[model samples]
Target: MSGPADDEGSPPPAGYVPAEGRGGFSTLNGPYFHRPGEGELAEQAFFARRRHANGLGLVHGGMLSAFMDGVLAGAVFRGTGKTGVTIHLSIDFLHMARVGEWVMGEARLTRATRDVAFAEGRAYVGGHDVVRCSGIFKLMSRER
Candidate 1:
């Protein structure tokens, strides 16, 4: 069977647009994309380039963790209209995603209090699970 790396030049699935204003560490790691979903939800995607792969030719765990962090943080922002820093993050790796695959992630705000927000997210390639994560974020004012 042809592995994901064989489809290197394929375009991203429809309705995805380049995610803008992703500065700093994200800028170095991405050119990420997003598709707006039902209220306060968005799906994020990235094409796993060779830079994202580890020595074994699979997407690195650190890359998947960082992607999940962004996904959960985005859920917090959209669901609460506020921003926050990650206080705690937990991730589970289920399957390996190879380079050149289109990995997509979705997250939702599970609960939020004045001080903190909780969210869960998963990353996948096609129908296969890659990583699942949950996070706690310390809520912050937009003015900060």
Candidate 2:
């Protein structure tokens, strides 16, 4: 997987960190993750190759879903300071994301309880909204 690249090639965005420990599934979609603002978690991805694209050359919907899942989960974890498991995810694909463009996912934890979290997020490419999603997660523990 590649990051959103500039003419000089891919570089991590400012304030972003390498999502090093997010696990193998996450590694496929992330090179960098950023907190664009308080309460918002974003992940940057480049549709660098056909592998990341659909037959029509747009980035795959499944890929966008996965991206949202990761960002939303991060938002929940950030809010609760604990791990959570996905209980449900609802996403709408609003636009097609093209190869070579940067797809940025931004999510917020709308509400969190002692054992659950609710979040909503969107994916954007060049200012176009590609996907909007909401999710529920079951907080795994209260410790921390």
Candidate 3:
């Protein structure tokens, strides 16, 4: 397991001021952002208001795709303690996740090279799968 490294190349994100968070958006941005020099595994939530339907009220394909991207990217963030950009992503829609339902996404480490990471991910509505995705994140590692 990768423990936190005190000698880790970069510094902690200076934006996470504890006091600012309780009041509003902190000077240090929230962990759920695409920030360089930060941890992986950022998550964003989607509520019912963000859903659309085929006259039957289901989440849109584009919305699901965006969620998957965020989830998989976050996984890549966790595996490598650095910032990365999504080079490509593919999604497989298994079933329609209805509106008012919540879908949770996760990224699994499939492979990793020095500059790239391959990850497979899925979105689950409760216990059933709603979407599946796989992709590569281009990692930018600063040489010491």
Candidate 4:
């Protein structure tokens, strides 16, 4: 978990807002609860075929990272109104995932306090975990 650290006051995201009335800090409620949009998250549909394999028919590794990134970012958006910076991320490929597979990613908050948050998530296919991620997000302040 290492990346270029951001100085204070970096913008989080367009709709970035603090997790209002959500305690001093917040955590993920599981995968299905943080749908910020229309079909993909709520409809429980698989959204990426472009990330699929080229030869042996497995999902690409970059695809794995992208999936993890999106899942964590979504969690950050839910836990805190604004978006969070992915300061640190570690992904472990547990197994191969193929195209046309319905998978879900969930962030399990290990800790969230102050301006930093620690969380973990697993990508599951058919109730089996295919990837695991541990992330450290730099929470940005929301203007009141």
How many clashing residue pairs appear in each of the predictions shown? Answer: 0, 0, 3, 3
Q: Residue 77 in model 4: shift from native, Å?
A: 2.5
lDDT of 2 by residue, 1-144 (tens): 444432323554566555668787767555545644554554544434456678787888888888888888878877788777999999999998877766777777899988899989988887789999999999997655
Off by over 4 Å in 2: 1-9, 36-48, 142-144
Per-residue lDDT over 18-136 for candidate 4, one digit per residue giving the tens place of the 0 to 100 score: 32233222222111223345222311113224224445657677766766766776666555555567899999989877754545566655666778867677787776788888888
Instruction: Please report the candidate that would top TM-score against the real structure.
Output: 1
List the candidate numbers ranked by lDDT, top first.
1, 2, 3, 4
Question: What is each predicted model's overall lDDT from 0 to 1?
Answer: 0.87, 0.74, 0.58, 0.56
Q: Supply candidate 3's per-residue lDDT for 105.
A: 62
* Decoy 4 TM-score against native: 0.62
Q: Which ten residues in a row have the lowest lDDT in candidate 3?
A: 17-26
Clash pairs detected, candidate 2: none
Residue-by-residue lDDT tens digits, candidate 1, 21-123: 8778997888688887666665899999878889887999999999889999989988888896999999999999998888999999999999899999999
Error of 1 at 106 (Å): 0.3
Q: Give lDDT: candidate 2, residue 66.
A: 84
TM-score of 3: 0.63
Clashes of 3: 3
- The candidate scoring highest on lDDT is 1
- What TM-score do all the candidates reach, one by one? 0.90, 0.82, 0.63, 0.62
